[model samples]
Target: MTWARIMAPLSGGQGDPPTIAAAVALAEPFGAELACVYTPADVADVMPWMGEGFLGGVQTTALESLKEATAVGEGNARKAAAASGYAKTHFIGLQTPVWAGLSAESRLSDVVVFTSDPARGRGPLAEAFQQMVADEQRPVLVARPGLKVGGVVAVAWDGGKEASRAARLATPILERASRVVILAAPKASSRSFDPNRLKAYYAARGVSADVEVLSDSGDAAPGLLKAAGAAGADILVAGAFGHPRLQEFIFGGTTRTLLGTDGPSLFLSH
Candidate 1:
């Protein structure tokens, strides 16, 4: 299935280029509706609540800050639209909290993009991105710094519902991939996991595949990373937990292990 409505949230920062680039590339090929959702800096947080006597000063400063932020977002969105070859169109600037706006937008869009750089600024977008993937069951493309548009796309396959869902949602991207690999290892002894079906699925769409069963290293994330690198993959597709607790969300199983501190762009689904 192709992503027809794609939303890329631009959190004006050092890591924005890679995030925007990936979104544009993916949307361009499919002729999808690419929207640059510009969420301004949370001014209310930066500006403190003041007494009525100081209301005038607060209002003036807030207005100027908002205007400046909107201008920057519009400028960036224009450049991105041009780079991606999408039409110069309606660029909506939302004055809302990062988390809330993104969550709401995610509901309307087929996919969202974010830079997987774990070293995020003090803004809440990073965590919100993670939460969206974990809770929304939607596909998120987490692009790394210097991410190329398309290349080797690897699937972290474990023969589970989430893994299957990730593979399904990423099918369009995979169809155009230069190479596709299934990073699988022994999971449940009762179940036999094979990449043949997945490989054939892609082959039907003209994409070839390779399979490597990582040596049983109880923890699969590291092995998966090594295999993906060996295959020259820059984009990793995987499944995320439905509701990882705060700590687990930050540091626990495969999803956390792969995402911790950011290494490669992750395309995740729940």
Candidate 2:
């Protein structure tokens, strides 16, 4: 099915612009609706965190910060949407937890887009994004800010449920891709399923795709990066894997590696 709606979260940061642009570009051809949602920090939680007899001062500061953040986020969203040629735009002020609001909104949309933070090394926001991927049951695209994307595209396929889901969600872009590469990581056991199924699928959609199986003993992110570079791909598409909590505890291994690495921008789904 063609994408009809796209949901983007505004988290009081300037890093979401590229993601917003990508989402709009992907949605425009399909005449999809674009909605931007911002999550304000919880005031109630701030009061408890304040020191003894400092509740009033903390409350005032927190409210001011929240207001500023909301204004900046909303303004950025509007500007980005307009620049990206989105026919319609929405600004939603979230009263609940960021993840909860995003999850709820994602249910109503075909795709969700999120930005990755490199300095904090994948903080709560990344976790929330991953959780949305695992829980939303919809496609989620995570884009790193400041990355220029176009041209060749690579799809990391392991024949898992997540891979299949990602491939389906990325069909719109894949259809327009100049070159599509399906990189299959080596597996120990012999399997009947062929990764060529995806190559054939893209070919049917009028995309020129080449399939290859790579034997690498290194990590998945690095291996994928190498393959993408060799294929001259400017965009990488893959299913986000690994348990969120485990990745967090390890300071964000797979996701962080992909986001921080020097390569083409990645489109992630779970």
Q: Which digits, one per residue and each the tens of the lDDT, describe model 1 over residues 78-163?
A: 56545654563234556646556667878988878776553232353665565567656568887776555468889988777888
Query: Which digits, one per residue and each the tens of the lDDT, describe model 2 over residues 24-110?
Result: 765676778888766545555565666676536766777678667667766765676566556666667676465577678888988
**RMSD of each candidate relative to the true structure:** 4.1, 3.9
Model 1 weakest lDDT span, ten residues long:
116-125
Error of 1 at 43 (Å): 5.6
The number of the candidate with the highest TM-score is 2
Collision pairs in model 1: none
Q: lDDT score of model 2? A: 0.67
Model 1 CA deviation exceeding 4 Å by range: 41-85, 88-90, 97-100, 118-124, 145-150, 187-192, 200-207, 242-251, 261-264
Q: What is the lDDT of residue 269 in candidate 2?
A: 74
TM-score of each: 0.76, 0.77
Model 2: pairs clashing at backbone N, Cα or C within 3 Å: none
